[model samples]
Target: MSALAMNETLTIARLGQRGDGVAETVQGQVFVPFALPGESVRAVRDGDRAQVVEILTPSASRIAAICPLFTRCGGCAAQHMGEGLYAEWKRQQVVTALSRAGLETEVLPVVDAHGVGRRRVTFHARREDDGMRVGFMVAGTHDLIEVQACPVLAPGLERAPIVAQHLANRLRASNKPLDIQLTASEAGLDVDIRGHGPAGDALRRQLTEAAERLDLARLAMHGEIIVERRAPFQLMGKAAVTPAPGGFLQATSEGEAMLSRLVLDAIPKAKRVADLFAGCGPFSVRLAEKAQVSAFESDKAAIQALSRAANHTQGLKPVAAEARDLFRRPLLEHELNVFDAVVLDPPRAGAEAQVKRLAASKVPLVAYVSCDVGSFARDAALLVAGGYALERVTPVDQFRYSAHIELVGVFRKTAGRK
Candidate 1:
């Protein structure tokens, strides 16, 4: 066997699932980051992974990255590709996953839901000898890369890094690594700091003063509220939801609205709808506008927020919420039969247990929202085998210039099949 060379020029044949370029080599397939297909690049090979040393010939799809920290920060992966190629690669992710599951269906063009970019941004902070360092971690390393500006953030969150640094400086006395989650809401920035222990009276006072100076709407530490200048509320259709501290939210407002529209349109006439894995009633509250919604989630805070929003809103049908772990005790066939349609937005793992029961139910329509295409394909195949036909699949690009893709699949029960 020929010895594998440490440095070699190779042609990228394709893009991998994580947005890395795959180059076939004598040793094996080398995964090169920031190299697009049809491009020739020189890389230092280490087994299957390679670090691109230089681009010998760039692909036609290659484009300059908007962010200066594109290669340094782990937040984005596909920013170097042209807009058309970027969208096609993301769409292909869904198509490849469904193909692997032996399912073929019509997939609509990818939706550009990254309107003004992400509304929520998380920055890592640590006390430095000079002062404090706040930024995203380096790609594939724990080292922090201090950022002065970020291009992918919404206009409302343009000062997120600065705001995080300000908080880090105020809490520098703790000398602990912290994760500052800044979410842009209608009121103002909702700040949540994690990894810090319970604050003392002095620290609490400092935080209060910082919040006032920063003009923050609310501040929380370790999921506990410290101060509230105003309620950090998000409008979902006609309902107002104050999500829990550090709770899950759609990356962008446009993405949430797009996903909700796709979901609602799938089950248009659903008299009774069951929203599984409902987080803060993003889909449940909207669905309730035309259907009675029964939302089930594991987070107590999320369920409370959903119920409160549902109760306070007017002209909507009944909306009930239960804090239940659907993974452990999914709504069974008989329980699922009560609802005419079901909508589920499961995490990356894709709600296997709940999907199994849903496949056995007599529900006429289903809207499956997923972030992980592989898991979505697995569950989708299950539904297909259970006599449901995939009506349409729409890929949502909430995380632009990155490998991550979100999708909503609409399925309807077909006749003459159990």
Candidate 2:
């Protein structure tokens, strides 16, 4: 391509789903990062992607970014969008996805569940020629951007980057890449290190010392405990749950609370509830407070943690926690008859198999929680085809400033049980 063709000033028509600005080029649509709609930007063009060289005309909805590493860090997107534009953009993501699936319904406004910022973060560490470099990867690139602090993290994780760096320094001799996941818990910071094959006794002892020095509650390597200064826990409703090392957790405390509230509100009078793909019983333990909950998940450790939390907490109804991979063996339609309501918080792939069974079952209500809109829309279409009405969908923003969006959709059986 010629220099003029490669470097052109383009007008951004709109924002794409991934938070990139869409500019119609002669070839097709070129996605430009950090550019907003109604703006003219000079960019260095690749095939279908472009890097913004200058914002020739800034959008009125553009605002100053909060983080110094905004574009370079790649951890956040849409940080420059004004509050109004950002909210609408996120909500429209759900609306657009559902519309494409031919399942149009009331999509409530986007809920800002980013209160106090994220409680969990994973820092990537690489041992370079100079030393160990620790931080997040740049967007679409493997290059690490060294981060000292991240404003998006909860105050409890204020020292996360420093702690990660210290841990990296300790393992620099191994010369292996590391992924350090840190979660701020009720007791203190809970950390798990990955990619450090097997820890020798000497290394374990050193990690124990490092954990103590860092004031960490617990430290583990690949889910195996190396040190336990204290049992780290998280408060879910009235119960305090000590999750499995480095297990899945909602990004923010407020996000979990918001999602739980939405789920609870949908099935107020249900006496029996089934929590599917339930990770560490975020919804199961809470749901047990009122109804008998049968929690199912593929992670045995998470189920054990959930059961222990339920057994220890008083005033909650019986919670039968079982370890089962729903993707392979979905609870059949007849088996689903025991529960009056079902709540699913599946991963990004969504619960296609489980949802299909629910679609044919006699279950009255379903509170479907999803992180990916496309997957959720596909599953919702299946449920609707099975004679369920998607009452409404509420989008929750937990990973603030990022393209990620969480949502809770309530489906009610409109036709008699098949």
Candidate 3:
């Protein structure tokens, strides 16, 4: 390889975050996008980027990407890899992160999904002179890209931004102030709107009339805008929109079901459980059927959803929901002993201080769900150093084709401890 070369091929050796193909050519680390971990391929080592040119040796894991927007859409990155391989890679990603962090113990099996289920997606939109431009964030930046279709819309609002923009234009023609939300639910289109500038009777009529044209079932309006009576719409059989802005929850019902199952199974044998960072009762409601669950989340709005979920379940024990900033103020060390098992579903940052306290609190078993492998590994090492034995690690494909991977690992307290 010369100091300055236009095009050169490099064999990929491993994987990294952002779903890149990692390789080394004595030039530090070269990451190849769109290439799997174990592929001996001709990748053009561009200045800051690498592209797969030819595959000399392909890992059994490589598969044809199904989505048409595999290269264009920024929603997911690993779609081109085989479904089974994708799952395996995800598991390995966590294991690698953990192993490097000094938790070089047994990493368990992983589960595969034919298609990653994405329930909800937020699209960016703005009114242009010609038409309304709408789509997802650009690959590396927040610059929005206009798109016709997305694989991740919950259901009813599959073409939400497009449809909403059209309605907004009609309202504009009729001179109405318009803010809109089109929620996806099996129950159908439930919309909400808030407006202040223009919506007169004519604009309001136009907005509702446009929604009627789209065959929407329920619609509510405020000022010059039409909005869903409730946000997020109810999923499955629920009767309300229970999503908070930017607060993490499963985007797809299928994903939620899969993720919820993992949390429930993590501590199946336990009686009393504490579900940390339990947002909107995803796992808490599911686990409630089998065990007494105490749920905790930082957001009060999320806690409200958990409270409602607890009230609705029949045989399930309503989870005790508490709202607190676990980062700033973690669960007290003494309080960790109140449960037989502790289940944590933290965000990408993973559980550190909480895991440290759990290890010190003498909890018998802990199941942690994490989005970041590196963080999971670090936290797992802390637990292991504190004498927690690794039991099982399961990775689920929630967001398919992307660099992001979700994992659930169960750790048991080491035996014969002093």
Candidate 4:
């Protein structure tokens, strides 16, 4: 065996972004896969590098992953850490980010909103001579690891790949690959077929036939390929969800609904609500039924979705949609007065500039939902410096069995009444 092939015992000092055990051997820095922090491992730096010869000491937070594909699939990184500890790591991550920014706010314990109505999911597919193959990318590479089921998908979406593969072949359109996205709602699945629309209903019929054979929930097609059944979805705001394929949405249905409710709980009943960075208006539309919901997003497509959802309802507060480069051009101080309560849901980058504006603004209340702890914490600090008391930071387990943590927090001026 080559010297590199020999297994050597080493201790992992820290965790890497991809959840690998990051440690340095006397020889050099070595990254061992599947080794947990605090564990001592004997590993061979194989091309696929990882081996846990022995765990000298285990982390209190270390826990086994439930999914068989947990280690091999790149979709999840922190699954090996148990839920309780996972929540804490995420919480601490958030706290640390805020502290670095000089913001102080009380972060509440994480909330678990598992097994509920998550709205949108995107699936990948590959064209092959035999047929189309679909599944998530293999853990770290572009290579596809085809599978019949994905535990992370909503129960209905487990067959998404199977359905998409069949349609691509039946349509005789293997040249253009397909990305199938499913969005769920009370009405059912809204299927968005992205990439290559077939010319007419004749093609739609062939696509429909393919969908029927696969036992799909609903079916739609993009340019050339057909979409399978799932849910009837409109992007919610002015967004098409298609143009921005990776737009942020609640990864799970339960978490999405819960986040909306939390915002409602935090804000006092008001005539207006400002949803900053609102993608597709899931919160804005729901809130619009009661209070006028103003949804702001950088993407025009998202604004359109919000507008349509707003128009569909009655006895509902009006929905106003606006497109702005928020990161570049955030709402000014004078504009903040239009809203009594602000519901800001930024991406993992979080709302740093918005938080600064919020802190200095006289707005009485704020509801913040974040996916990344670091950004959330930084913004939380800003909110704190602005005289807002961190009412609570509740972690929402939208991505179960994964290290990612979502937080919904309500903040208000310390001097202002709750």
- Identify the candidate with maximal lDDT: 2
lDDT, ranked from best to worst:
2, 1, 4, 3
Q: Report the error of model 2 at residue 221, Å.
A: 0.2
TM-score of 3: 0.80
Deviation in angstroms for 369 in model 1?
0.2
Cα misplacement distance, residue 268 of candidate 2 (Å): 0.5
Instruction: Tell me the tens digit of each residue's lDDT in model 2 across 199-294.
Output: 999999999999999999999999999988898999999889999999999999999999999999999999999999999999998899899999
- In terms of lDDT, the poorest run of 10 residues in model 1 is 1-10
TM-scores, in order shown? 0.97, 0.98, 0.80, 0.79
Find the candidate with the highest TM-score and give its number.
2
Tell me the whole-model lDDT of each prediction, alpha carbons only.
0.92, 0.94, 0.68, 0.69
Is candidate 1 or 4 superior in lDDT?
1
Q: Which pairs clash (backbone N, Cα, C closer than 3 Å) in model 1? A: none
In candidate 4, where is summed lDDT lowest over 10 consecutive residues?
237-246
Query: What's the distance in Å from true for residue 163, model 1?
Result: 1.4
Candidate 3: stretches off by over 4 Å: 1-5, 36-44, 52-63, 113-116, 127-130, 141-144, 152-157, 167-183, 189-226, 230-241, 244-247
Task: Kindly state the number of residue pairs that clash in model 1.
Answer: 0
Each candidate structure's count of clashing pairs? 0, 0, 19, 44
- lDDT tens digits, residue span 1-418, model 4: 2555766677887765445777876766677766767887677665445556667677777777767777677777777775665666666666666667666667777777767434566666777776676667787787776666666677656456656566556644646666767655434444556665554767777767766675555666652335535534544333223322234467776777788888888875867889999887888877776788778999886787667657766556787899987788888777987788899989889888777777888788899988887777778777776777887777777776566777887887776522
Q: How accurate is candidate 4 locally (lDDT)?
A: 0.69
The candidate, 1 or 3, that scores higher on lDDT is: 1
Residue-level lDDT of model 1, residues 258-323, one tens digit each, is 999999889888899999999999999999999999999999999999999999999889998999
